[model samples]
Target: MTFTLAIVGRPNVGKSTLFNRLVGKRLALVDDQPGVTRDLREGEARLGPLRFTVIDTAGLEEATDESLQGRMRKLTERAVEMADACLFLIDARAGVLPTDEVFADILRRKNAHVILAANKSEGRAAEAGLIEAWGLGLGEPLALSAEHGEGMAELAAVLTPIAEEMAERAARVAAEAPETDVSVSDEDDDEAVRKPTRARPLQVAVVGRPNAGKSTLINKLIGEERLLTGPEAGITRDSISLAFDWGDVPTRIFDTAGMRKKAKVQEKLEKLSVADGLRAVKFAEVVIVLLDAAIPFEQQDLRIADLAEREGRAVVVAVNKWDAERHKQEKLSELREAFERLLPQLRGAPLVTISAKTGKGLDRLHAAVMRAHETWNARVSTARLNRWLEGMVSAHPPPAPGGRRIRLRYMTQVKTRPPGFVVMCSHPDKLPESYSRYLINGLRDDFDMPGTPIRLHMRSQAEKNPYKDKKNWGAPSRLRKHLDKPKPKKG
Candidate 1:
């Protein structure tokens, strides 16, 4: 098992800055404003020779009630419980506040290993705060500037022993575990051969409008309160990804910030958050467009699903909060009708009803996701595709433009994963967009690839004029001379 480290501190104490440095990427959004990070963000961190998983938690707050701040505090405390070690950070410039002292004491009682650090300790102004950090009494306070990359060597040195200790503990646990009998029949061996050598984690991103239960659904899927979820509309600011096993399938799921209309996204932080979520969608192989059942298939929801379709990603529409719905069958039928009418481009896509709070309909959601993925990656043999194309063209022949007949000669699938195809034809430029849509729809229906994006490209493959470059190519020499002589006599 890899060592786990949690960086916990008050807001704007440069916790995100240090996280970015250690991870060697600007993953977590950093701003001068406090509470820029509300959800817990995890990344693989590396410092010199040490490598481990590091979690950037929400800024520790003193709130104990059910408000947003209180919810954030509870999430951070959960991180402290799960981590192998905690790095208690304080702003050296501001010295130690009462909140810092209170959190430090809580860490001492809860966590066995705690390392205190005074950030922004690069200058003389932070000297007093560094001394104050030591008074917290967790341990010797390491003075470092997260932004300036100072004290990284000292931090790495301190973490080396902790890594070794974790490795030792893991070894002991492995040694004490029971071993299975090593017996393989011929059938077992053949079954093993049929299995894949390795399966990479599937990349899935859940996105929707604000207050659509995106975060809550993800938390339910992972079976943990990993993401900060409450009655708040925009509790998630960063697109946090969590790697876990979803019913025996390894998956990396992204919980993205709720996307709103472009005109309404006025704040700088919100803009960044939305952009981050968009990036996640681009990288994802499958996207689940979450919808609030009460106001399902709104303009924003349709736009989101269409965006996923345009990106050539597998899409599954999930109506969340179904447990609260009053009329189930009528709502389902209405939703289906609206889905087909408003978003015909994604016709035949899976529409599932789910309740993130009650964990109902998740199995169906999982099956739909897997089915969509399979369809997205489906490939058609070139011979089969050509046969189907011939039948389609025979059934509805190409239209003639300007009294000249257009020919459809050949067709083949060019790629998969949101399958692409190329058709060899006469006057590709003259092909109408409606005709192209006709072919795409045919492919989706005949090939059983419903709802996945299909790309069709027309290419003119007419052979070059064979005799254009040759001399005396038009007629025989004698015939050419006779024609020239006749012309002179007539004059």
Candidate 2:
């Protein structure tokens, strides 16, 4: 179960900083300038064992209800209402002002679970402001330095009980009415999974560098001239998504502007177009990184692929304009090698060579997409996962560092929809990148999972295991220990 928390405060109170601290990443852009974050950015946050969805809202300011700032405040209020709890941040250095009081009144009227956080409280300078926070009447204020991470443990303690309560309630609800998948025939499945009738169609965004045949390919797939296409570059300005069906699958396809080198994009519209395209990529479940066959792997193309990987979205590489290439066989082989060399993170990804203009390999492209999507949604049983882990360990044993061979004892798929696996092992942080890649590639090949991105996370089990002291005993541990142990004396 997951709960939602909204971080609300006036401008430049380090809301974004606190958000980055909670999410354990700099996902929200943090700038010293006020109002840098104008929109609400959400991320999965974790503190110790507590996990929840956290929203970083835009800073509030005084304005009329019709003004932009007023609208942003309304949005923040809506977020506060939707969240199970709210983290009301105040800059302890700046001290409590009228804006903070006004927001405090608003929060009090809402009667939401508010955790007053006194940010920037690292030194004597912030002491008076921290004392002033008591006037808000919310509760005991948590003196925190979001940037320096001074009081995260205290904040986590406050949030843990609320999170546990929400989790328990969710468990009860889930227990009362368990969800079961009801398989339906293809014909019936259409109605069951139709966009308008059922859930919203999965959004898929096709993005790449300029002249990657993005518009042409989208037209080919939709079987219509929905978007303007030409040999000239920069034809599409806005990122547009169209709803269509491929066989039985209902999908929303986003045709985006040709992304160029940041320096090359000078015009205001072009900048907006690029931003819109990125928004599409962020929102989409899967993104197809279209590469022009002529220039298969450009620097920008690799950047786009890296961005998708960083964003945790499933990706498929489509080599567009394949029919136009004169040296087809050699070029395809070269492209494959380059893909392997450049974007190794997407190793074993689906790379389909298709002519968007001629529609030569449309069926193959669709099949590749469907296969990748399935792999993205793939889940493996615990028994099968352990068996695969055993095989992986046997193939290429982890190298010993400091006379201790690393042991990977257990593996489990933590989440799917771009399957993420967690492997419990000794010195998880020390696991070589090459070894991790080997495991991931093996999983892809063994499971017939192609195209979709797979995440293999390693976690240390230092104190969790009770048999750490007995290095040479215990049957269950001995079995795993033997796998890594050097071959017994040949004699």
TM-score of each: 0.93, 0.55
Which regions of candidate 1 are displaced past 4 Å? Answer: 178-199, 476-491
TM-score of 2: 0.55
- The lDDT per prediction is 0.91, 0.82
Put down candidate 1 lDDT per residue, 116-202, tens digits, no spaces.
Answer: 999999879998998788789887899889999999999999999999999999999999999875556545653244222225678
lDDT (0-100) at residue 74 of candidate 1? 95
Question: Top lDDT: which candidate number?
Answer: 1
Clashes of 2: 1
Candidate of highest TM-score: 1
